[model samples]
Target chain A: MFTGLSAFPLTPFVDDAVDAAAYAGLIERLAASGVDSITALGSTGSYAYLSLEERSRVARLAVAHAGATPVHVGVGALRTSHVLENVRSAEAAGASGVLLAPMTYQPLTPDDVFQLFATVADATELPVIVYDNPGTTHFTFTTELYGRIAQLPGIASVKVPALPEGDAAASDRMAQIRAALPDHVTVGISGDASAAAGLTAGCDAWYSVIAGTLPEVALRIARAAQSGDRDAALQASAELQPLWNLFSTMGGSLRVTAAIAELLGLVAPRSLPLPILGLTAAQRAEVARVSDELGLGG
Target chain B: MFTGLSAFPLTPFVDDAVDAAAYAGLIERLAASGVDSITALGSTGSYAYLSLEERSRVARLAVAHAGATPVHVGVGALRTSHVLENVRSAEAAGASGVLLAPMTYQPLTPDDVFQLFATVADATELPVIVYDNPGTTHFTFTTELYGRIAQLPGIASVKVPALPEGDAAASDRMAQIRAALPDHVTVGISGDASAAAGLTAGCDAWYSVIAGTLPEVALRIARAAQSGDRDAALQASAELQPLWNLFSTMGGSLRVTAAIAELLGLVAPRSLPLPILGLTAAQRAEVARVSDELGLGG
Candidate 1:
């Protein structure tokens, strides 16, 4: 369930509320796509911007519309109690797994993060993926801390950030992380642009943002790498370099992904939560132009 | 209202609930301590770990019990709408000012942070304090960015983290920040250990975490500096070097302050929110010995 491309969809909004119909459509689309799993309420989903009720509803909606695909729900919150509540909500919503990031305001020590993971792992029956996206959560996990957390019960996966650029370096990085954890915990790669390199470097999964909206394209790269066609995987990713550039320069993937979604008519224009003004009109036009040139929009 | 000693009280918890009796007692104590102001929901108050309802209740309680001392509420949230809601709550609670940290989950751009403060400044009648606590928020503010935000309407104060060790270096740092803002916007200093140096270096306010627990001692330092008695202020701070050393070595001031509160019988033992284990018993006893030696328990 944790292997291959885990598509993370945006939880689109309308008039300051979760656009349930639009969100359900997204899940149904992901369910139709042959990705390994569907992860809802990821950073791409703007989980941090939502209320508890909204998060719970999003979790339930993801499960209900995902069809036969396993759904992993992001259950990160600033408080351990809130994270546990989110985990319970995910469990009740019938999620197959939970992604836990050490969401922080206070600068967290390694022990603080380990304790947070330990507490959640103790409370939940579901498999936990250590969500290590320092870009959003601002809590970096050391390899030693990763080893400590993976030793805890129910930590089934470790979703690491981008790998080093070259294949040898990326592989060396992956090997270092793998040596730190037990064999059962799969290592998944995030950072959409680095997916092909990471996949070719032997990461078990691509925990992806781009795959959520444009599944066929991400699937092309993932399948090529998984089937040992490294050139094809790299080629597929290289074709979408424009989109990756947008993600890097324009703050992060969330707003640009929202722009792409809006362009494709997959979600409402200006669908992101407030304070996150999705993208400038010119930026959206650039995204549309790049996305169209690459035949991303069907 | 933003000058002198602005005490940041801990919102102590017992059995994972906000101990209202203990919190109110803290506010009443600060109110009678001749401190310039009382700031509720600052990092010392554990604002990020609280729910909206709990935060609103704490805001109201601070206003209700602060007597004649002006009360400032930290009205920061991950979402803009939620931050506006907190600002509205503080205004309705009769708070004199609101502290706005660009509390982030998704790393914000300078534009995003500026827009956040602008939006909040527009929405509320209460004056805004630009909370620049990089240690907690993981968002560092540039002097240029400070100039930009201070230009926004209703931004009254800037709560900076810490200053350099030497008096001359701290004074230069203060001058650099002062040059970035308008004449009306006051600069307050946080970081309990740096309060004396910051105050002596011409910071308008000492946003003291220790002051929240031990107002008289903070007042002694703050008053000495404000009255141009720099030697007295430095001497007073030097006398409590043990307490300052504990804060430096023990994660931060919150745990040490909580330990001191527990030792002083100001709040219930083990009062911090879950996942933030206050301190080991040995650490707590160390705080006790230091506080007792400094005559901080009285």
Candidate 2:
């Protein structure tokens, strides 16, 4: 269930509230796009920006809208008690798994992180995905630490940062992570730009951002790589270079992706939570131009 | 109100709930101890681990128990909206000021941070202290960013990380910060170990952790520094070197401070939020020995 494309959709906001209908629509679209799973409240979903009630509602919404598609809910929070509460909410919402990231305020030591994972894994029956997105959570997971956590009960998979761009580097990175974990634990890649290299170099899953708002493009690349058509996967990913470039220049994927979602009318005009101004009109026009030139408009 | 030793107290928890009586007692202790100010919900207070209700309640408790001592509340959140809400709560609690840290999940840009401060500063009449503790927030603040933020109207102070150890380096660092910020915005120093040096080198305040628990000891140092007695200030800080060492070895200040509070019976045993196993029995023994030897007992 964890070994393929997992689309992470935006929890759009309108007037300081979660746009429930828009969120459900995005989930329903992903469910019909043949993606392997739908991950709600991932970093791209702005989970940290949400309240507990809002997170719970989004979890239920994802489960309700995603017909037959396994849903993994992000349950990362700063406190252990809150993380457990989130895990319970995910379980109550009938989620397939819970993604745990060591969200920190005080810089955490290795033992601090290991203890967090062990505590969560002990409290729930749901499969746990070790979320290792340092770009968002600011906590890096070491392979030794991964080995420690993966040995614990209920740790099913690891969502790692993107592998290196070079095939050898990517293959070596994947091998190191794979060697650190048990056979039952799968390794998935994040960082949308590195998805093709990661998948072609032997990653079991592509935990993608673009897949959330534009699943078909992400799936085209994921499917090619999974079928052992490395060249085809690279070609498909290369086609979206313009979009990737925008992600880099625009200070990360969230704003640029929000712009794309806005352009496609998937969500409201200014959907991002406050203080994260989505993008300037000029930037949005650039994103639109790139989206159009790449034939991404649906 | 932003000068001298501004003690940051731990928001003690008992049985998964905030121990209001214990928290009030800690504030009363600080109020009587001649500390310059009481900062509730700083990193040591576990603000990031708290819910909105708990945070709001803690803010009120600080203001109510502080007697005549000025109270500053840490009003930081992942989203700007939540931050604004916290600001309102702080103001409603009659706090003297609000300490703003760019607590992040998604790594923020300089512009994102600037906009956040601008929006928060514009929304409230309460003075905002720019909290630049990268160790906890993981967001490094450049001098340029500080300069930019200091230009905003309600920015009254900056609580910066420890200055360099050397006298010359400390003076140079403090000079650079003072150069960046306006004269109206005072420069305060965090990192208890570096307090004497920071104050002697020209910091206007010591945003201290140890002061919250052992105000007498911190006062000796702060009073000496404020009176221009550099040697006395250094000697006083050096006397507590054992406690500082324990802070370094025990992951960080929060656990060791929690142990001290427990040892003093200011709060119950196992008072920290879960997954933050306060300290091992052996570590507690070490803290007790150090506290006893330093004559830190009340």
Candidate 3:
């Protein structure tokens, strides 16, 4: 039921409290844009920072804002029970599906990894989207692991966050994965860079983080790729390319999102969680240059 | 003042109920064998499996058993608030210190890693031990991080789980760490294999897991190390080396400890949190072969 452009927004926190009013405002703004669904509590949202009560509030708030669109909750935790708790809270708060990553604390073998997803799928009524971002989880869902998790009953999609920013190994991996999996299990592009190439390689959705701040442009880019308008997709990508320089680094990935969230008056970049260090003075200058180049402030 | 073998016992669950009597028996046995202190709610104790209430019970149970000896509670959590709550609970139960790892979900820079320790230290009056076992946290404390964390008030020791099983890098890291830090703040070995070499590299203690199962022998080994009796220490290590081999694979470390706790009739391994998978039958055979060689099993 989920397709097209999806925005993973930086969750707003005011004095360590879930800023519901800010969330309501952000939700209202994203809904007015052409974004399809809202991935609530994505890593960008500082989902781990939210307590069960806060997650329940945001899940409900996002669902309420999206109206008819699906609201997906990022429900990965250090342990299984923690994720299950997130799932239960997500369900109670009216989420349509969940995006789960493997145990962040320990790396699991393919069998254990499969069992984890199977257990969650068996427990929930909602369709699950398995998040395969090896960078965070420390273990990649290898093609073998992917083929197996594909057979999981409620899994509707695999959001492979590995991008083809034109690396040979990455390209080969996506192609190998594309050839092995069936179509019903949608292969979407996460961090959705090189979107045209991903579409050509067989991605079904453009799951973009920048989509949160630039929904109309994201949607246009995705549609152009989907319809084989390579020229249009290229134009949109070039306009979007300026921001890539700022967002591709470890710090920028976090800072610019929080910065944009702030520029749009969403959330300050200073307050997000771990490994995401704050921006340095040079990084701030780079972000400003990119923002001005794209006329993003306007 | 935490040093020597502070054994972490598993919590036995019978028919889904906590076996307080069995637990009491386990603690009494550790005390009799002369463990320096008891460490409860660690990965070995299946602390992750326990709810907050269960964790509090385990801490209180261990503290009561130790009497004069101190207990160090494992208090690492993904959120700072959770860590604070755990510290409060552990402190109320008479824990002497906390074994705090870096933030769980997000990759943290060394600065934020320092912040996690500082924040937890602020929440409790107890001494804190800085943990750098990247096997769980995915990020290790640089020697710089170790030096800074060691300087923080109440940081009694630094634990590095990477030990050389003849690997020169492990030995090198240990020696480098020892040379960088002050003598008042002891460096302990968390990697079981490093017991001898860690001490050789200037570490003061072995944060031994197998000690929970074979406290008498474990104590003998550690005492030998402390008293500079290398022959006795090696003999003791050779005796318990079988148990370590069982939990040495990809995700085996904690599960093996909890299982050995069960083998010694201290706690049930099955009580471990859901996502915490156990070693396979083949791995268990390795544990058994080692145990048989050591004459540990009747």
Candidate 4:
């Protein structure tokens, strides 16, 4: 159904190679914690940075470790052919579905965006989740575009980032998109902080970053929101607000999540690509304070 | 001294593979028409869409066909390590220099931008041409960042897209960037339509698109502008304005240039990636009319 909390696990690296054992452990932990699904090779997973062979390896490892939980692999690339190749690899690796984002160096028109998704969908029997991440791709998909995309065979869901805090216009727009899209197309909210509001507004699921490392907390909030327990959901959301603030202030969650994962000994210490450094001592202290207050790490 | 008219050759495709013979012929035509240099795999060449091995093959073929003209290869990638790999391949391919743009899915800070270029520059002996194409890369380099990048060991030139039509502010900004950069760093202007104004404003070279297919005419305008013959340069530019208007109206030059090249039989018919199809019938007609008026093709 593509609903409930889907955890996006970080791809742990050791000496620039994918740390297979640590990665499998992370997936196992998420599954044990009751996440509905696992999305590997997401933005936090450094999908774009990994080589083709490495991505294929990660996809296979994630599927193997996920056990009963379905794993959705990101198959985005600048070229459609490369993306198709990734999709084939995911299928071979036994991935449950594929997440597609329109990534290009050029400014792609709406027609271009449709063509990319349509071509990909035509090539794969696996369910496709359309990812609308304008912040990274610099390409925005209108509700009109989404409606058209939903008509494509095998396109079963969409992952939309929550609007900025307190933008009523954006909230209204999300509602409009939900109403316009086919009832069969599940719409999930992304961005850790937006989960509370997005759920209250009737999004089908929360594609969570924090859930990757702290699945129990994320699942509590999602379950509360799903059952219409506003108070419980908001209370859990408030508990994680400190961590969310760090993610927002840090420009992205990848480095902060990686740092937190390392601090808690969830993964081995490894270097990220240049220009994306780990958290500083001050940031690490702040994370520790938040984690301790929330009893996140054992 | 990577100055004057640098033609960015299109990577011709046949049966979904790089058409090596047609590609060689395109490079030969550009060099024969007196281009100052040839930049293979530039935006016009669809560098982002090509595989690593294909890019290497194109780089080697370009250098071979360039004769005495310098060949510069695009080395932009999501990972710094990949860029370094490409830089090494370009050097091995005998490319004279490398063009680099900061390409990442995440928004990069100025410090991140500096580190990307610094690391690439440190790894190569080839002169680096800093490409500031905000349209494609979605990353803008401030003049301050350029100042820092210019101080790097191997950086020798900067390619700035010409300001939008009638944007005096952007022209002034280019001047500011030129003044801010080290004296040894040459500044060139891109966007075929902007050549006249960019040259009149003192940019050292015209990194051109049309020049790849219609090098004789592009070179005429550039040479006239270089010799301080503003009247001749503007007159030549006026002749190309109809074509320029098409480029502006259509949003980018890749499809337009591809259609024109095919119309003129400059290269064999080729396929672009889905979502980036060649110009439509109406667009092709406009291109043919403009090309005919400019005496670009038989």
Ranking by DockQ: 1, 2, 4, 3
Q: Taking the tens digit of each residue's C-alpha lDDT, what string does model 3 give over A1-298?
A: 5566677766776555667787777777778875778888887677866766777788888888877767889887756767788899899878888988885565567776787898899999988888877766786677778888878788888887745556465568677876767667877787645765666555777667777766766787888877888678867777777677676674436567777666656665454553344566676677777777787775
Q: Which is the winner by TM-score between candidate 2 and candidate 4?
A: 2
Lowest summed lDDT across 10 adjacent residues in model 3 chain B is found at B264-273
Residue-wise C-alpha lDDT for candidate 1, range B1-298, written one tens digit per residue = 9898999999999988999999999999999999999999999999988988999999999999999999999988988888888888888899999988888777777888898889998898789999998877778899999999999889899989888887678888999999999999999988878788898888999888999999998998999999999999999988988988998899888889999999989999989887787788788878878887888878
| Per-residue C-alpha lDDT of model 2 across residues B133-203, encoded as one tens digit per residue | 88777788999999999999999999999998898898899889999998999999899988899999999
Global lDDT of each model? 0.90, 0.92, 0.72, 0.85
Candidate 3 structure quality by residue, lDDT tens digits, B216-263:
756777888888887777777666665655666535666665555555
Query: Considering only the true interface residues, what is the Cα RMSD of candidate 1 after superposition?
Result: 1.4
DockQ of 1: 0.68
After superposition, candidate 3 runs with Cα above 4 Å error: A163-172, A273-277, A280-282, B11-25, B46-54, B163-175, B239-241
Model 3, residue pairs in steric clash: A275-B107, A275-B108
In order of appearance, the predictions have TM-scores of 0.96, 0.96, 0.91, 0.95
Q: Docking category for candidate 2?
A: medium
Q: What's model 2's lDDT at B161?
A: 90
Q: In model 1, which runs have C-alpha deviations exceeding 4 angstroms?
A: B165-168
Better of 2 and 3 by DockQ: 2
Distance from true location, Cα of A192 in model 2, Å: 1.6
